[model samples]
Target chain A: MTADILLQAVIGGLLMGLIYALVAAGLSLIFGLMDVVNFAHGELLMVAMFATFSLWQLTGLDPLMVLPLVVVLMFALGVAIYHGLIARALTVQFNRGMVQIFVTFGLGIFIRGLAQFFYGGEFRSITGGMVANRTVQMAGIYVPLPQFAASLVCLGAFALLLVISRTEFGRALEATREDRDAVALIGINRDHIFAIGWGLGAATVGIAGVMLATFYYVSPNVGANFATIAYVTVALGGFGSLGGALVAGLLIGEIEALTALVLEPSLKQVGMFVVYLAVVLFRPRGLFGRL
Target chain B: MEAIPDNAITRRRRNELRCALAVLVVLAILPLPISDVYTQNLIILTLFYAGLSQAWNILGGTCGQISLGHAFYFGVGAYTSTMLFTHLGIPPTLGMFAGGAMGGLMALLIGWPCFRLSGHYYVIATFVVGEIGSLLFLNWDWIGGASGLYIPFHGESWINLQFRTAKLPWHYLFLTFAAATWLVAWLIDGSRWGFAWRAVRDDVVAARSLGVSVFRSKMAAAVISGFFTGLGGALYGQFVGYIDPDSMMTGSLSVLISLPAVLGGVGTLWGPVVGAAILIPVRELSSTFLGGSGRGVDLMLYGAMIVLVALARPQGLVSLLALVRGGRNARTA
Candidate 1:
């Protein structure tokens, strides 16, 4: 019975870890492309979740059906952000780094305000969706269908991201990351590549958001919690490393699950934080970070 | 960078000191006519943030360490004093310094490990550490946990730092606090440590190569910054007469403490004062009018202003003063 309970926790952790990986992947992609950490990344996730909620509420479509639309919407948002605020922030002659941090941070607060203005801070969940309130029992372990399906979809998104990384656009992105100025010399429009990278990053997170909306509660402040976790994952995996994000995400997931079992569930995040601090303190550049 | 003559630096410092004294004198009398509690409260808050932001500027601005987790120190100061006052029968006036000491010690503790990482890594680490702190505080039942600790009103007394009938005392108290922080900044501005810190901010590698101990410089800045921030937090707890994890240690509070310094101009002595003067008033007024129903219009406006300021004047609002004076070059005050 003890072994069964442990197996159940492991499976639950892995499933959640897959979704965490997708979220961190989006962050890692943008950071790798341009040394900018999107402080507003979580708000983008909140927007996607809210979009899913609104679409389902309006058209009676399941979250799965609305995934594509939400992805497109988020992609546009990502590009618009890059063009509107980030572009100007990059040109500042004084305090360039501080400018970028505050600009994105301010954007995040603005987005959160918009969410609260519209949604009224109430926690809303999609009820009666395809995966809601269902559980799959396999090999004497039980898993919620919403989480299981979300993990599967997140895994597929990871595969898609991997595939994209192997394409021509991917080569352009790699070259830009290597040297932004050098890429411009090679006939690549650095600005265009940056915008597309933001879009791709947004789209990946959008997929995760839509899946999470199937099970998780949605609210104005919901993104803050997830954003912290995403930051930890990225930092632990070593910033800008996709493979590192995957491994770190899974590791964090298992740690969280085990911590919950051993300690109080309310302190689950404490375990992940401790592990992150330990790893970063020893390595100084994270487990897999190059810079 | 060309080295300025010693007399010129000394003259600038003297001018700055005179200017600061003049401003304080004007501020001291400006509040006498206003007896309305609302406006008085606003002035006090503005002064409080001015002080808090100055503390943030010491490390974040001068030393070039952008800490998003200062709420930890702020919370530490608040909790330390409150617990001492409530549980041990200790007066908060003394407890305040104790809080400041703890805050500085905590900064050293956190800085010990965090100083190893730089750039985005350090920023995130501070942030996570803050969250860990608040979370732990939220669960620790000994300190009242999430229910929060409420200071029992022990009537009006300067020793206790509590007042019931008038807001005037708090205003002057906070004004003095703000001026004290400004004075410290002024002293640091003229000191060798000031040059060392700016060097670290501009380029750590070059600073180290120049025989400046980069780690010690950052750690020193952190201690001083955390100490003043903690002092401010103790004052805040006494003024509010209540303390909670959400109110004292949230991520938003951390952002609030740093925003003024960022907006006014990081590393500038006058930046926090000017930024807080503008930001705290606008924030308070907007929230009073628009945040009543919790629609978040106030938040939206505040966020928009930050974005606008950061994008339009990256050097800070202080530089705009230089522009108005038509100075070809602005000295780093």
Candidate 2:
């Protein structure tokens, strides 16, 4: 492959990886605190994307401008779902792992179905004039403006989450993660904290989703595809480590993008999984995963 | 009553024989009476899933190792047999056995390193194996890459099991396979090895303390599980006459085998049968109308069922049914 093409792919992959980190960081947050792997996390992002799509359609609001509304709505939805179904089920005698997986998976499907029913299956994009189409040329490599914006947003969110986790509330979240029972003995309302964590996680992905929609097409099945990638990223980063998730997400994006330059675009996913499996074999705890 | 002991024993034996006869009769009559193409297709699909799920149950349901990547074996089996038949002119019937051998061997390769980890690690390893298979199949130009491969059509061939007739032959073949799977599952459940498996699943450390070869037991489970799943792949390829990477290796297909068993009752004889009965029809109906919309309708419904069942009744409907039957038996006794 030509140096320019390879360099472009690496940059593209790195940008995609940042977005993956954003999505996966939310997954890490929810999974870390509640021990619930939300299969519908991607669907939450899909919903956010659709929300932005609708707002852009009706009020002509830009996707970036609609981020706050998307985050709030998704956060509320996540909290509601956690309280309504998940919390109660965790107390019961059952296969919590598979059951939660299915529950979230079901929610994902339902959301996707609703999206299809309301919006149809046509690919939807929230494009706004020259910025949407504009690309910067650096050393013979083209970088789309939207992608660059998404990367910036991703990094910004990561920093904000880092700050939140270090605060008192964030410490409670850490305590919640270390031991749910111990967290309760210390007078913390674990359930409420968990709900908040889940909400934040969902809301974070909501921002990622809108950014994704800006760069690519929005469809019902898009969430499922991205969810699998998110799962791969989570596993690669170590399940509950946010920093690990970010690093793993970026790594996957870079690998996929770089591979796509030399190999068929579809085979890029193959490359992503190859790296994931290799990580699992050699370093099961992930790059920054706790032993 | 004391004077008629011989007669009582004979009567009990006769009753057992009658129940067996009735089951045979039902299985025989199912395909013949159903003429509707959709209904027949659904039944055949159910039987195919029943067999596949039963095979999956050995590892996932029985051993409590939830593997979402059983399709690795399934894909390997499909590609191996299809390739053999098309390229080397080997009969698919023979190729199927060879395919199963390959799958079983591959399981041994992966299972050795994976089974050492306690919980969820095995699940992750299995998922990786499946992804690897999918990747290799998708990228390797030898297997047509992402474009996929198609088996040549046949008018009538005993060797190929290809026919231009109705779905009757395929239906019978799959049904026979399902019954064989049930029989094998029952045998394993009752065998000494089955007890060892239960011990390992319940507590590996305890089983090891008791001198059970936990590693060997799990490997055996994986091998057997992979063998039958491979058989499923062979059957799937021949029936559809086309094998693509996505259809063969996707998580959705893996769900077809595992979800039913999970819903029915893992580690139980009738789990696959029950799961197939409930899920196959629903899946068919959903795919018929709602599948093409690219919406998550089918998946949502399927996931809801799994979650509800897992939370409300982890033992599944089969176990519940067994409990009812068991109560009646106790009362009679």
What lDDT is reached at residue A203 by model 1?
A: 93
Among these predicted structures, which one has the highest lDDT?
1
Per-residue lDDT value at B12 in model 2? 54
The C-alpha stretches of model 1 lying farther than 4 A from their native spots are B1-3, B327-333
Give the clashing residue pairs of candidate 2, or none: none
Docking class of 1: high
- The residue ranges of model 2 lying beyond 4 angstroms of the native Cα positions read A1-3, A137-142, B1-24, B116-118, B289-300, B329-333
For candidate 1, the C-alpha RMSD (Å) to the true structure equals: 1.9
List TM-score per model, in order. 0.98, 0.91
Candidates' chain B TM-scores in the order shown: 0.97, 0.91
Which lDDT tens digits does candidate 2 get at residues A85-170? 78866775656666676566666766776777777788878777335777988767789989998899899999999899889999
